[model samples]
Target: MTISESPHEEEPLVASIDVGTTSSRVILFNKLGQEVSKHQIEYSTSASKQKFASGGARRFSVDSAGGGSAGSAGSAGSGAASPSAARQAQQPIFSAEGIAIEANEFLEIEDLERPTNPTLTFPRPGWVECDPVAILAHVVQCFAANLITMDKINGDRVSRSLLPYRVRCVGIANMRETTLVWSKATGKPIVDYGIVWNDTRTTGIVTEKRNSTPQALQDSLRAKTGLPLYSTYFSCSKLRWLLDNEPAVSEAYEQGDLMFGTVDVWLLYHLTANHAFVSDVTNASRTGFMNLDTLDYDDELLKYWNISRDKINLPKIVSSSQYYGDFTVPQCIKPNLTSVAWTLLTDFCSRSPPVPIQGCLGDQSASLVGQMAFKPGAAKCTYGTGCFLLYNTGTKKLISSHGALTTFGYWFPHLENPEHSQPHFALEGSVAVAGAVVQWLRDNLRLIPKAEDIGPLASRVADSGGVVFVPAFSGLFAPYWDASARATIMGMSQHTTASHLARAAVEGVCFQARAILKAMSSDAAGEGQKDRDFLEEVVDETYEKSPLSVLAVDGGMSKSKEVMQIQADILGPCVKVRTSTTSECTALGAAIAAAMAYEKREDRVLWEDLKDVKKWIRYGGVEQGAKSQDGSAPSKSCTYKSQSLDTDRRRKWRLWEAAIDRCKGWMDIVEEGTGAASNSAVKSM
Candidate 1:
């Protein structure tokens, strides 16, 4: 399928925002996957050692008798406030004392001036947290900044004299499993900071629950949640930690004013001006609360977690590519931009109707869509701070025995029954440290001047020179599920230089990814009759009977040729690495989802003109085989075939596996030492 130019005019553009761990990005994509304009805002993740009051500490008493314009400005109304109003009323007014409590029902001018991006804090080692209000502010700031920039670039096209270049919809892709709980009445977070996805502070909570819970019940949880109770990498344990430790969160829960959400839901609620409290299935599935088979919150899982259904307001689960709600630019961020740009954007938004937030996905799922890995057995590896390799398992939610996650790929809104759409499932292998290893080398070790320098520095070395580095900084995720595993570098000698260590770091990431691929292949092979046959066919068709045959790669880390080469070399000859031509796959994936939903819902003339456009945009479509607009066949991807000798590769892999085994139980040793200390203290007492 190809994009056919419309004789009339260009269609309204689609926009997507990717809220990542380290940075947030906004991108505008035409229907054909070409980037029009993009903007990114980078933020620090280093934890501040200070504590601040929760947003809810700021209380306001509303005067129901006074008639005010706060109603028109989207404030929660007087009297018994609506759910949305209650949330709005809870928004904190930032002040010198941290966040100030106000008596007024409406926001004062000073409240709008407070910055949204809060510094991530680490109160203790291995614990990572961030302020939810600050995160909300970052989202709003990115949108306003990007929209203002986009409008300036295309302002002429959106003139009153011409057909306006309306933004048909916005799509969101966010880091998954980062959990937050807020007040239903005031919409303020019960705690000052959200528990980030990678935070391991709740490891003890998960361990205690597993030890106390019945074996039969634990088995049932695995069946229902498609996740193990062994790791704190998910939302369940994080939420549990909050309820047990934070008085504010527990108090709100007891009062029936708590609402739980992943980052996607939090952004959606604020973006729609608090009207929508929903989460797409892709993001919801990662929370460990939603059932894989039912695609909804599981009562059994809730009971297992000791969470009451009535106490916390869970987001309504929706399809990934549906009209979630309309987004109005919040007034708070207007002051941050230049006066001219703000004026133009405000005027433009006033002239144009609010756009729908039509698409939402967890970052990994969005990358899968963006990579166009639509077919069963199709796979993509996103190399971000951590690497995520997702293998499309099609419709079936195949449980993984090899420790890989069985996750929702996406849920497309079916025309006849939009709400109850069937979801696609994927087998995911999450590496806790991929690009982060490179960052460690740069920041902690000072091996390289900058992150990009790793590639060149590592290229100076022929190989790791027998050095093997296992980056388990936040412990191992996927396949191993080892929270106690710590970073280990084995077989290092005096001859080992910075170059060798750098090379080893890159190889470590590749080795981890290869392990995940092997696990996925094993899980697929273990499937039932129908899936086994399907898997066989997929292997024959896509990989010529070889497992781990094809991989689509993207993200900042994939830009390193040394890394890609090592990845290809480590996986052996049968495996092929295909890097995405465009690095913006995550954002593009969201754009594609939004465009598809808009086409189905609106059925515009422009879409009708391109009726033959591929039902799903596959990664490298324009390059691999798809026809371009000018009727030319585009070039294929930059593919790398494995160059390592089979015997040597096997030997290296065995050594790597051995090194990983040595790293195991390292955390257990630390725990034992702590336990011994506690026992001695008790005896002394």
Candidate 2:
């Protein structure tokens, strides 16, 4: 039941399943902190109409958003509608800001818009989604496949021959902030089929609340609610949208029968056969419905949305790694059983004493843990579809000034006792596009034959040749929250090639990340010295207990050595760029949480210290790289000096700033043209 004591004796198996926006994976880790066995299964997103053709020629869509037609899901214009209403539509087609497009010209983006292989479809203009059924089916498939894969890998022959190599506990790390409310009575999702994270349908509800509520009162609500009242991305807006749109949900709220929670809560509910309706603190932090001070649901938030208590099924706020419920396969996957799986499940079920749930943090939180940025100011940037950075702020409630969010850090195992400060806080900033930009190149531009080729190709030239690409494929997010900006590639000339575009794409991502870091520093109340102070503080505390000197990087995209070095060159002055040995930082974070929870520790030491990393670098006096006037690379790129490089990057940022401004008004033009076309439709009728 427990991890074996011997060094070579395999640790008790702990399963970490990552349910990401793009795919699902289950990894089984051994005692040495390495993967023992694993299985990954990819699922498809809803097709877009614009890319679909009956002809066999299979031409890829060049649209920034996914497949759909010009007016379909992946449309270029940001649609107009209330925030709450638009949030539910699931399109990532907003403008430069994180806000949703207006309803009149909905940008129909496909969920899966890669270049190599693509699916095409266009539903009605307003319909966007990830069919709940497909999600459920995928989870089931991953679970079953992982178990089956484990059985095949550790069959009877291996079990008898090598007892050290077996699997043990199972835990899930999921995409937080994505919520769905469904009925418990019928065991079905209550809302429309395609409620995806990027949908911004609930803008109106959020705006109404902001406009109606007094400023002081609203601020109090945010402080009490422990969440911002900005857009429809959070749970409050989604809840409001359901009440406004769906009569059944509205009635359930009235009758006290509406149940809602994020993806993890829903999955656990079904996984445990309704025995567990608990959400770990980290996931709950994202709902904007939880009281930051109390770590409990805010009654006032529910009241503001006019949702009655009895009708909604809510998850209990609990520590990340505690016994949520016993693992029992859902009824649907039960029949297709194997003996090894049966044995494994039976072993897990028979615990005479209840096994404590060891660790539970949101996927982002887990990545923070996995990166070992334990100390205050130590940070990590996770490059997925988007880039999210979390700066551990110890226990302080550092409010954001530059659009960064203040969120609960990981709730350590020891914090479960009432006497402890259960949740730590962090200054968080999220950029909506990162690796997705590379994906855009692969899927949208058809510039790269394979995604992995981007790094080397980008590194071929020292700079991006004055090309600056804002992967505002969806509107911008964090620091500069412009909702109406479209993806724009500026500074292009006759000689500009796809290689320049590729390099610019990477730099654009780094620039966005820099923006997040800048905002987080300002939020921490470290005004003028925010950037430098953060670096120095992190480096000093983490490395030699001196000023901070470098940044630790991880995630799938970190595999690009050129990108990491470029990041280092840009950051300069002991800015160490370190990547993890394993690409599964998120998974590692989950395991660490599970381990800490099992051991009942206050905090587990991080994997890498910023101070220690500072010592490893040999160059201290080198000049940092300079940014050209066009936001392209300078002739000599890798020079690392604090004074020279900092000045130019700041100057280059102005170009980035101006480019954002130039692209901001594009949506109106698209909308007007579309409006005329729509009038023609009416006139024809």
Candidate 3:
């Protein structure tokens, strides 16, 4: 891929602050994928219990002994207060020594306006959510942290080792479908709680559309939108849910006061002080509102949804790599405590032509860009909390039949040539839970001593010993959107050891990944695009012809060599695990996007060329660079090949599928147990 040189590159740095569901990260990249400097901080989500309670009890009333104005006073205290204020009220006020908690804990006047804890929570089943205002606060905090970290490590020895050492521009890549209705006037989220992708409350709306719209019409919409009618991950479903259920949102929609967007657009508007309410084509495509063919919202779609184009402010869909806006440190983040001289110096130093946020794509779309799977039929599986596989389908649309999603690959700007008008597409498949099972094993069950220990423990046993763990924790997604499903560990016996369970958990993730790939292949076959032979060829070509293919795995789980080997073994031969030792792929991907946008390199070279891959080490349990530290070639590349275990694997896979069937019928049992317990509690009360 094209790497921008110092002489040809533009001035100022681009920055990307990725605000994820679980944590927040800030990254800086030059014109090359090389990371300049980066910082990561984990933010806690509101507890599950709080969210369930909040969503259940929608009424604002929390009665007090004194009625009348007391209720009004309580309402005013909670409603008039900012999110920051609400959070501050929850924090315990301490004395100088921090020994005693104050009885009447009063928030300081200065702290009243800012929330001490601005986090998201899932208040109920089928309702994954967040506080939109809190998300903005976290964004500001992450940016400040990046700057501070870079300043502290500017001259440090560690900084020099990690980066070639220049920070120029910043670009933000975010979660695609998490959406909100915000007001342009006050710059506050119109919705108190942000609806995230996992929220299935919109099922009713999606079902209605599927039932009313003709099959041909729905197919046409799917072909044009690069999305499936069954998808609840897009904003279309969430938007429909709000419009149907929330009267306020519907009223706002009628008055033309509503602004709708993915997190990227929401962030762009807020970052630029509401001057620009736009998103790149990558984010737009996933909305289901945007037509994949036109790369704009379809008139029919808007009409069907009963959303007036004039009423809803839609962002201009731009290329993934382009200048969006400049970063003017918000006044909220400015250090008011510092002297005027220091404040002026800081402001002057930070100010630069908005570090060309040259690259902007949804996190998954960006992963495709980052993986460098530019050619059609080329695929990559990103093993993270979730497993997502994207097969590049070039410019053609391939509607999925086997649960695979059709999504936008990238949007190249129409420079001078009219031929480059439309955005490219990819066949995308997502596995909701992958490495998350490992986290559950670590945190919830304490199956392993530590998170990383899972690898070593699983290594003790070569395989899962017939134990199949279907980690349908929050229900199965992609290929099967079974919302009622929960986790199931079947084929267990007295002989099952901790190691067996651990191995099964890892294998379960691999099974899901394979399931998605199987579905995508099946869908393509059904579409008459290609059959299993073509798909096998795709995998074969990826390994034999492509530069790298041992699943370029990243994320916290990628650090586990044992896990990688298991992933390879299950997928069969010629599988190569190509990645760096560090779990820095997300940051690396962000850096790459920023580089591509700012440098404005040859679109083909930047996207399709093999030069972007600086390292493609084979997957080995041992921690060693695919290449030597001296920048020399490796002695050999590791390849995983299956040996006469097809029958066994197929048997295990069938067992896994069977386990899902059993889990499907489990809701009744769960409800019965919960019902009996609730009855007992009521009697006690």
Candidates in order, TM-scores: namely 0.83, 0.76, 0.76
For residues 459-555, write the lDDT of model 3, one tens digit per residue: 8986778898988877777777665678889888898999999999888888887677667555554443242333433422222233224455555
lDDT (10s digit) by residue, model 1, range 309-366: 9888999998888777777655655544445545544664554345678889999999
Worst ten in a row by lDDT for model 1 = 61-70
After superposing candidate 2, which stretches have Cα over 4 Å from the reference?
A: 1-10, 48-128, 155-161, 192-194, 208-214, 225-227, 335-358, 415-421, 525-548, 599-644, 665-685
Over 4 Å off, model 3? 1-14, 30-32, 48-117, 152-166, 211-214, 332-354, 414-422, 523-550, 580-582, 598-631, 634-644, 665-685
Question: Candidate 1 — what's its lDDT?
Answer: 0.70
What's the true lDDT of residue 143 in model 1? Answer: 55
Candidate 1 residue spans exceeding 4 A from truth = 1-10, 46-117, 155-164, 331-353, 415-421, 537-548, 599-636, 677-685
Candidate number of the best lDDT: 1
Q: CA lDDT, every prediction? A: 0.70, 0.59, 0.59
Extract clashing residue pairs from model 1: 47-121, 48-121, 86-185, 87-187, 90-186
